[model samples]
Target: MTAVRVAVIGCGSIAKHRHLIEYDLQPGVEITAVCDIVEERAKAAAEKYGATAYTDYETLLKEEEVDAVSVCLPNYLHAPVSIAALEAGCHVLCEKPMATSREEAQQMIDAANKNEKKLMIAHNQRFVPSHQKARELIEQGEIGKIYSFRTAFGHGGPEGWSVDGKDSWFFQKEKAFIGAMGDLGVHKADLMRYLLGEEFTEVAGFVESSAKEGSDVDDNAVCILKSASGVVGTLAASWAYSAKEDNSTVIYGEKATLRLEDDPNFSLVAQYVSGEVVKYELGGIQTNDAGGQTTSKVIHHFITSITENTTPPIDGEDGKKSLEVILNALESAETKRICG
Candidate 1:
């Protein structure tokens, strides 16, 4: 079988760290080209991977003979680039929150459907080994019926992560669409829905600009989510976890409470109401400002889906639904009412 030739759009920190490294980890993927507005970044990536480089994404789409592309651009450009790639007959793996809005997300999905190509959102949190184990335990009824849960994803803002530092597109409302809620909160919202196997029927949120001055985007958000199955919880995303990154969750169930990534030695802990406890030896979440590489299973699965001609686990529609939580949370915070 011919190897899947791939290109990367937007050679930023995510592209430089996660996408490029993960793509290299895959067996039958060839990095054919890279695109970025910054010639230096693109050239560096190209030199490292021995791939062609292009500044204009449209030109890359038209010129590169690739099987797929990773859309690692700003949140706003995700839909446009992905739709263009699908139209160009290449599968797309987009970084999340899939698009700026639900409508744009739908258009991306529609494009994938029209082209018969896979569109997988890079919501990497769900792929964490601890998270996977939690899902497995939930399905086996190890945690019993989940009654409530709380999940949060936060860090010291994208300045610590983005190559552009404080001036990155992540801090601008116009370019980022939404801030921490979209950047970090949407990730937990997606993970919440995934673990519980439920849709967030309604939500009320408090979105605020608590940090990161000189920008209009929000830096903190607290969202109250209710699943269709009567599960209630809080989902918080913030860029003001200046002390440390706080990506943690605890699911309360009839049998016990599962504390995930809540401990150093034990990544997961099951504390029964009866005073009995079980500590899982799984490694805790990546404990750093710069995320670790072991966490991103997105590329491997995306390439496998394309090579096997199967639907990706987190397809375009899944991305849209996860995005719905973020959008509705923004609405809920703005209107000060529960929104769907």
Candidate 2:
């Protein structure tokens, strides 16, 4: 097969660090175009990757003959931009929290279905090495019946990572819709779903904006999720961990407790009730810190799905289910009641 021509929309940190870099690394993938509302950022990325630059995504979609595009735009633009690309006959690899609302997420899925295009959500947590291994172990029944779990994705904040620093749209409720929950919480929500192979049926959460000054969206959130099979867990997302980033999950089962991304030396570890222990030295997760450009595998998977004419693992339906968990958490926060 010929190379899969690709464009990356929104040359922000995620696009610059993940999408463009990963696409350039993939074989049979060509970086054909780059788009950003900011012309300079778009030009810089396009020049670095030897691709055409456009300030408007619509124009890029109309002019460039691309097989796929990564929607790395802000939270608010995800749905519209993705739907536009799908309608324009391009497979889409959209950044997480696929849309601000469930209705918009459904519309994105509908557009993909109508156009017969692949629509994958960039929930990169599922692609992490230790995460993949843990899923395999669970599926193999290495850990008997999952009983409870606690997962967290927290860091100082996106101000240090986003292109705009403290002034990034991530702090704005209108642009971000929800702050830490949308940015960090959704990843854990999606990760738990993948690792456990179960849908979260109910959620109760306390989401707040206490951590970040002058921010309208939640900067700290704690949610309790009940899975379909009655497994319950705590999901915590925050921008207040000022010292070090914490992306960790511990799954308790009848046989053992599987810990992921928690230990410094081992990325994953399982301790049996019978006093046996197993440790995995899988590589580190991608972080906002310097020199943390671990490959997420999202772009490569998106390209392969397009070229192979196969459905993406984290397709629109999968993305919507994850988004639903966050949305229900938000509703639960506002109403002081459990939501689903």
Candidate 3:
């Protein structure tokens, strides 16, 4: 089988830790090129991964042998880069929080359609073993009717994790567009949508910058989401959690309640109405970078989708839906009213 020649558009943390390394592990995928605004970073990644390096994404896209591109840039750059990659005749696996706005997200969907290329969003949380188990129980009706949920993804500020520390683009609204909401909130939003298999109909939220100093964007956010199926839930995201929680979701149902906790591993606990609680101790779903393992699974799904001509697990529309939830949360915070 000819390997899928993949190019990575950004050499940032996510790209380095997840995409590049995961693709390297896939036997049928080859890292063909690496791109970053900083030449040295791109060159270093390319050298490490044994791929060509380029400073300009457009130049990297011009590589005739490239079959797919991973849009691993900052949140604001996702749509433009993915659209360009689709137009350039390569499939796209874009990092989450698809775009800063719904309109931009739609444009990406349109571009994917117009180019006849597959576009997948990297909503990796859905691929976690615990998350998948929860989804199975929910789908099998083992939990009975899911009436509500609570989900969150929190961590210490990006200062330490990012390559540039406090100078990282994550602290800048111009580059990141939003802080904790875009960074961690989007994951919970997407994960709930995936597990419940429902669309969010409306939202109300409160966002604040309580922890990180010298930042204009919100460092913490909490939102109420009402799904189309009449399920209601709360989602909380923060960069202020010193304990570093990655992502966790709890589902309440008529027959039972399910809890997922993130830390040493992804474990599931279910409490039935009979007053019996069952704990499932799931092993190492956490990758080197906390969520990187799931990210790898998401990439594998994208590759499978491309090869099989089937929809990716997290397609463009799936990606857009998650972004809409986050955007609505932001609007709700601003207007002090529910937003849809």
List ranges where model 1 is wrong by over 4 Å.
286-295
lDDT per residue, candidate 3, 1-340, as tens digits? 7889999999988888888888998779989899999999999998998999999998778754688999989889998999989999999999988998889999999999998899999887877778888999988999898898999888887786787889998989998999999988998899999899989999999999889988989999999999998999999999998774556778999999998864344388889999998888764455435544434487789899988899888888998889989999999999999999
Clashes of 1: 0
lDDT of 1 by residue, 291-315 (tens): 4435477898999999888999999
- Best of the candidates, TM-score: 2
Which tens-of-lDDT digit does each residue in 1-340 have in candidate 2? 7899999999999988888889989999999999998999999998999999999999999999999889998899999999999999999999989999999999999999999999999999999999999999999998899999999999999999999999999998889998999999999999999999989999999998899899999999999999999999999999999999999999999899999989999999999999999999999988778887458888878888887889998999999999999999999999999998
TM-score of 1: 0.98
Question: The CA-based lDDT of model 1 is what?
Answer: 0.89
| TM-score of every candidate | 0.98, 0.99, 0.95
Highest-scoring model, lDDT: 2
Choose 1 or 3, whichever is better by lDDT. Answer: 1
- So what's the TM-score on candidate 2? 0.99
Candidate 2 Cα misplacement greater than 4 A, ranges: none
Assess the local accuracy of residue 15 in candidate 2 as a C-alpha lDDT between 0 and 100. 88
